[model samples]
Target: MSTSAGQPPYRDAEESVGDLVKHASEQISQLMRQELRLAQAEMRQKGKRFGRGGGLLGGAGVVGFVALLAAVTTAIVALDLVWPLWLSALVVTAALLLLAALLGLVGKKQVGKATPATPEQAIHSIKADVAEIKERARR
Candidate 1:
């Protein structure tokens, strides 16, 4: 009788019961290690995306301040043609605030999309694998 590993497992035509069980155990261990590495890599990638999105928000703050100042100055200058000087300033300020509100809502939406970057895919895969193994064991 040939005892070579090339022979299929869990069959009298090949390995003993012990050899088959050991092979299955080793395979399972290797699979788990691979899954863990996948999860780590996924989380690392998500972390980078989150960091980039967050950094963009910070940069947007500085740029937004400059933009506000420019808009106010330009609006007051342009609208002064028809309105009193103080009234022009007030009108420009109100318009600028409304524009800022719109932009703020859009920015908030974009930032919200990139947060809480968990290893969701890996977690789902792990759950599925566990369920399959459990079902097989029951059989």
Candidate 2:
């Protein structure tokens, strides 16, 4: 029988089945590649955002350190009348050091939690797709 437009030509069942499997495999592979690329792009964007955030946090830490120094100096001048100047400076210096250490620890943890650059999700997706293709082909 003549095939109409938008219709597949009649063929043996085996042939039709093989063609279907081939087409599906090709489409799945294409989709898998696209997904991998998308994952890479997303990871890169996330890395950039994390870097920018880290930079901002570092800047804030520097500003805070400077402010702490200024405050300590001012307090030492004003309190020298009632307290030992050396004691005031020591206390302020210790507090500023502790604050710096705490900020460093927090920033380290934040950066550690950021998403990895590897396309793990895409890798998993492609693996699953391959298994499905294999299973279908076997049938």
Candidate 3:
């Protein structure tokens, strides 16, 4: 059946105060469920961002580590030659410094991605919901 004049279907003289309260309760419950779903979606998106940021940082750390290994390996290989110990130390130190500078930049970028993992959509949606509720209450 169709609702009359935009009135709720459950409203009628035969319906007691208890019925009205129950109807309101049911509507509130439905609204809460919808809001929860919205929050879940927003949190999921935020979580993905956080995970991606972590993965990028992990990658940066691994690359930096490999660079260190490479520096050490190069130094060790040079040791077998006629190179002096001081020369080998200098080579490894220079390589380490270069790697640190490059990797530091990349790692900073990856860390920047992970910042402020707040659920923006959820916050906006909740704010809207609160505003709407307030507006309706004023009426």
Q: How accurate is candidate 3 locally (lDDT)?
A: 0.79
| Candidate 2 positional error at 15, Å | 4.3
Number of the top lDDT candidate = 1
Summarize candidate 2's per-residue lDDT along 35-137 as a digit string, tens digits. 7787888789878987898899899989987997788788778777777988777776788789789989997997687645576777787788778878977
* Candidate 3 residue-pair clash tally: 0
- Give residue 90's lDDT in candidate 1 (0 to 100): 91
Q: How would you encode candidate 3's per-residue C-alpha lDDT over 10-128 as one tens digit per residue?
A: 67546867886798778878877887888888888878877898899899979988997886877767774867777777777887789789978997997798677666777787788
TM-score of 1: 0.67
Name the better of 1 and 3 by TM-score. 1
Candidate 2 or 3, higher TM-score? 2
For model 2, how many clashes? Answer: 0
RMSD of each: 5.4, 5.6, 7.2
Name the best candidate (by TM-score): 1
The ten-residue window of minimal lDDT in model 3 covers: 8-17
All models: lDDT?
0.84, 0.79, 0.79
